[model samples]
Target: MNRPGLVASKPKNWSIFQQKMRNFKPQMRPFHLVIVYGILFVVSLFITLYGFITYSMGFEFKKEYNAQNGQIEFNVELQHSISEPVFLYYGLTSFHTNHRRFLASRDEKQLAGKDISEDALKDCDPRISDGIGIHEKYPCGLVAEAIFNDTFSIYSNSSLIKPSTANIYPSYETKLFRCPNDDCSSQRVNVTDPHFINWMRPQPFANFRKLEGVFVDGMPQGVYTVKINENIQGGQQSYQPSLKGSKYFVLSTRQWMGKRSLFIPIFALCISVMCIIVSIFYMCVSRYDQHLKEDYLQRHSMKIVQSSDKRQY
Candidate 1:
């Protein structure tokens, strides 16, 4: 005979198991699951669309130049309007040449008044002086002076092209200097335009002001070539050097999309497709499982009815 305590504990365990099964019912219906998957798929699709729009909304033009007989030449085909001022930039992969004079001028202060002391002008002086009145001026020391020295001629196959005026304006800075008067000991003066202050800096670069006038809009579209030649004048009359082997030179209308611009759209599209595929697979599996459960329940109910009929008979 079993003990009273052991016999009573078996019924309590069975009751607990029945209660757990009742509480463990599926939290969501098939319709609700399908709705969730649909929402996720829609969100992924929106992400893909945004990326595509961002990738398609910019214009850029690029060309490469190779030196031929100590001269560089390339053709540029304009596809957009150059109604606004265009900027010219140059990038060098390796700069081993002696650009110390240019670097010094960039750091020099542009002070006002012609009667300033010689020591104050020495930093900005593009000329090499021996302090005994013997001085030699070099054009390669400053960006503005260097660009003027290297004359660039733009030519087009069409006769409608017109020449535009280009000018180089100096950048200025404000400084307070000690004055002779006691009432006002210091006075503010405008200094140089620091060449080091530029967005596309750390490389040898220069901007040809009013470059857009050279390539205006509504002009006949064709192949245009810019001929770059070094003018031998003053001290440069000895050895005339061209801008060959300068590594990189870019002529762009404005900032536009780069190669990495398409990466976002492509990546978003791939993720969207994956999300859609996963949702579809899960929906199919859920329907199949639902059908299997319904078939099993129907068979179980039929057996219960057959047993009751046998007992009644």
Candidate 2:
């Protein structure tokens, strides 16, 4: 009797997308394992050591300061004579400029010195309209409005430590940003300033530094005072003030790797360790196989000798 959902006999069948495969394990070879993995271990170990050594050689000094929007001062005592092309930077903590909404809050056309119309700045949101929503800002955006307006100057024994005048920012960027429509008819914001250019670009990290300026010849071993004219809210009279974030004064020499990171060296160390472990495993397997081959040959030779003696008898 034939069942409703069962068959008495089965038929051969195959699917077009179906595939079957079997992998065969080859005999372990000691020489290949040792040579290949030994080279990998050596190369990766070298990179791990080199990366850490170079990263630490760069000079860096940091000091935390009060979140003051007014004048502030700091006395920096150097431990040693820093190298040429030293940088001065200001950092902010707990301010995430990389948020999806925060990063996109800018009018590229408006910042290029073109007169962007008031109605076209939908991306700026609340920043699009002024405090009362009566008038619109020229380069209407949260990024432009929250520009870190702090200025810094270094002094050694009252002699001003002048920063390098060479433009650190791109020429096209610095040149392109000017007050759209005749200086925006205000004194509170200077769109032509390079600091404004730096602020417009969003940072990847929550806590990051923006370059204040650079000292091309570097500084001699001595104490220096820094004067800061702090203006966190852009010193705007009409604009709403933002939250006061912590500030840090950073003096760092250019590192071989542009930004400071430990991921590369750590990654190299991990890879090197893995290569050595794999090499050891294969090496042990090869040694065991060699022993088995030697033992079988010895037993066969003994059997042949025994048979020859029996034939003589």
Candidate 3:
């Protein structure tokens, strides 16, 4: 519809406008643009290299074990020799600890060694009770309920290698949190346990490994037998209620930065590549634009000189 006071004009040609846009290019570019991006490329590359170097600072060895009829007993031969004071980590995949529902499911006071009324937990709602008792699941919610309870026992030859769990759980955690049942014998949770403490800390990732224990006298190159007490499907199910995941563990030595992770180096490498690519693109544009400006100036100077001579005549 047309406005009351306005009249439409003949449609203007768009082909010329499209042609001008196609040939248009910026005449002026900051001369130092290339230098700035070049520096960025160098800095990002250095970071990528540093990340890889740090990743290689320590040694890592891993083995995957699957539950068979609820039993995970396997012998893994350590191929490479690792330094002493090795750390052990049990890993689980497909467990989402960062889920909003799971994270919001536990009662803080109850976990902090205080006995609170079930009605106080409005966020937990129907999840508060699983028909176990009207009293509610002691450490209610999917978060606490889905706690990992699998135990790992590693042996060298016929001798058992006992890893130290001393100070594994925070000293203050023992004081801050407590099980509902005094002595915590009848409770489903042992808040003081190192494994329990570490698990409760929460991981924002689904596939991850948590520190299990440390071997003061690190592992050397040899065949070690790992006997896993598979509870969820075998001994007593302490992992995911359903036996549907790849359960494994690793024996690794740490640098000052802790265990080796792929996130940092990979991210740095990607940034380095992007910087180089963008730098190249901009360099090409700047060089071509410079040529266009020079050509325009040559034609303009010639016209001005000819007009001045004609006026003089």
Q: In model 1, what lDDT does residue 52 have?
A: 69
Task: Arrange candidates by TM-score, descending.
Answer: 3, 2, 1
Better of 1 and 3 by TM-score: 3
lDDT of 2: 0.77
Candidate numbers, best lDDT first, in rank order: 2, 3, 1
19 Cα displacement, candidate 3 (Å)? 45
Residue 139 Cα positional deviation in candidate 3, in Å, after optimal superposition: 3.0
Candidate 1: RMSD to truth: 15.0
| Candidate 2 lDDT for residue 231 | 63
Model 3, 1-313: lDDT tens per residue?
8865555453445867445446556544545666777788788788778778877767677877767766677777767776668888888887788888778877778777787777886666546775675787667766666677778888898899889997666777776678655678877667767777788877878789888999887778899888887667222343445646567778787654457776766887888788778778888888888889999999999999999999999
TM-score of each predicted structure versus truth: 0.40, 0.73, 0.74
Backbone clashes in model 3, listed as residue pairs:
70-234, 231-236, 231-237, 232-237
Worst 10 residues of 3 by lDDT: 233-242
Candidate with maximal lDDT: 2
Candidate 1 global lDDT = 0.46
